[model samples]
Target chain A: MAEETKGFSKEEEEWIKAQRAREAERQKRLSRRGGDDKNAVNINSLMDIMVIMLVFLLKSYGDDPLKVVDEDLKVPRSTAQLEPVDATVVTVTRRAILVDDDEAVPIREGRVDPSQKGSGGQSSMRIIPLLDRLNDAVEQRRAEAQLLGEDFTPEATIIADQMTPHRLVLEVLYTATEAQLNQFRFAIIRSTTESVGGIAEATPEI
Target chain B: MARRSREEIGQPDDPDLAPFMNLVIILIPMLLLSVVFLEVAVINVTMPLGGSTTKDTDEPPDERLDLSIALAPNGFYITAAGYQRPPIEGCPTQGPTICLEDDSVDVAERFEEARRLLAAGQDADGESVMEEGLQAYNFRELYNMLSGFKEDFPDESTVRLAADPDIPFALTVRVMDVSRYRLTESSYDTNEAFWSAEFATETAEDGEEQFANLFGDPAFAVVQ
Candidate 1:
């Protein structure tokens, strides 16, 4: 064996030294860490909390009685307890009124134009364009319902701004009623502080 | 701060989860108790089929007292829609006194106070000073009168919440609450021990079912 080692090259001798250093380093690390990895943290309990948080967050999401499309419309606060059912949407912002993303009525500075047949300063109550579009949408929905063999109760969710005038709201209602979309849901911010028939100590959340 | 369950403080094989478990145990129940993490509710605001709907009346016109409330720039007006009775004004041009009651509660003053607080910033309960449409109207007096009106016409199912073209939709909704239900005082009625949850789950005549809608909430908004 001594003769074979003498026969070996200088590179082989250096490789053996490096291997010894690596083995020594490994032994040192194992001893320092008490024969286990110290970098790992016990995260099983944290995972439980994460799961719980996910479930809670999921439950709170998308449960609104009505889904609001326009982010501009700040719904009025209410203590109404009825949960929202899925339906066609009528979104009335401070500036414009839309039905299923279609601009059914034009509003300038929160008032319908006098030029519009059934909106603005005009007292006709029938938003002609709005009515027409809603009727078409309703008819299309009715057809879909018929195809699916579903009972179609023309359900419509009115998503209006809290600052929207009562006049505009009435106009929307009128237009909706004329279109035969009667089932209504007034979108509102959930007020956990107020209740029906209780002294509404809640300050108005605009 | 956890006591050793397995007597393995420095053991690298096991992860020390006592602290995390402790936090989660407290957090789960707290999230369960909160309303935001649970179900959200909505209100059903429906109108009659035709252009306008008259109240259900079997009595003569004189006996039928239809409650029609109009909110204008000057003040709040309560009138008999069925008949042509002159409106009873609350917060008229002269003062805050409504229906001969010596109410010192100044609607404008209260509104200013509320606005100041809001400008400075406030919590949900702190904003109670400015109820119903965010106008500086006397909600207490309004409540007192409505509650009395409820006594007068216990059978009245609908109330007309009419407003000027300028009145915002939010105020109308708040006014609806004032007309249809009674509000409770805030939990923190004092200097100490503020219980933020003071709202009562409304209970109807059925007792078990909540949402005791005081006015039956058959309200209508007149356009034009």
Candidate 2:
């Protein structure tokens, strides 16, 4: 064994043989103990952390009623305090208009496609495609409300990008109005700061 | 039977949690992906029931102030009870409308100055520039003007908000916001604490804080 240990001094070879012997002794001890000492990892602390993280994530997920997901759609910051409610969502991004996450109309250069407009093309306030989609949604919502024996209030939430042109917003509103959605809500990022300077206060006198 | 019992007693008490750990590993990433940290809220607005134009009624119009604000690309055109605001002498007019071009209340300039200070690593009046790209709308002046109107017509709550075709939707929302509330004080230390500090709020009978209203109800008008 000493001859087989090349490039190592006698003392170094002796150390290596001692290490091997210790390892073998430990292995023998493990085997005698029914091989149960295979580095049992303590994951109780890890499980506790994961459970806490899951609860937090779940809470945040359920808090928001509306999810504004488009990358091009940057919702404007405002001090409006009203909490968002579940309603028919009308999302107007820089590129397209979506009704309840379904693409209804295509927008280009901050203007609705002229062909999608009614009579006067880009000059027309009524967007034909958006009107059709909203009409369908209103009908469906009405039916659902009726089935549940509740009064149907035609409400829509408009999730528009901050850079969206007023023309596009008007067209969407007009289309929604035609579909009998009288109550319109503009979705905005809620902030308490006066940096934007629009603090909505309640007027009891009104 | 004796050997089996002995072997069972020697077994580890810890259950096999590998499957549960695997499940947690998968679930955490999926939930994290769908989680939204944004504080999203909504501003309620109503469309005129009879379209853009008001319907004719046999009864005479009440003393209620019919305030209409037209948001042009140049500036705001404010009209109340059929009286349009005439052009101010010193302020340079933007097109035909009476532009409120007060530099002291210019929101764009304040935003720019705040941004410059923040970029230079200096304090910006306790305000951090949260959003970029400010329009030239004089929101402070607008707020002051609306506050004055609220004083004159305390009972009036509705303001007709109409915007030119070229104006941005964000500007329209800003106009609605300024029209809705009256800021009692001018300055605040932090953005989060501003609402409680400056705004005129009173506690209701039920212990809820009641915000002082300016023009709380804003109706969208068609740009005809």
Best by DockQ: 2
| CAPRI class of candidate 1 | acceptable
Could you give candidate 1's per-residue lDDT for residues B74-164 as a string of tens digits?
A: 4566766354334345334553233222344454454445444444545233246544225444444555556566666766656766777
Q: What is candidate 2's lDDT per residue for A1-206, written digit by digit as tens?
A: 75678988888787677667866886887678666465645678999999899888888877767866445666777778998888999999867899999999888777887898999977888899999999999999999999999999889999997667677787888889889998989998776544464344231110
Docking quality of model 2: it rates as acceptable
Which residue ranges in model 1 land beyond 4 Å of their true spot? A1-60, A65-71, A101-103, A118-121, A147-150, A192-206, B1-40, B49-51, B55-57, B81-133, B182-211, B221-224
- Interface root-mean-square deviation, each candidate: 6.7, 4.4
Q: Which candidate number maximizes TM-score?
A: 2
What lDDT score belongs to each candidate, Candidate 1 first? 0.60, 0.71
Chain A TM-score values, per prediction? 0.62, 0.74
Clashing pairs in 2: A202-B211, A203-B213
lDDT score for residue A111 of model 1: 64
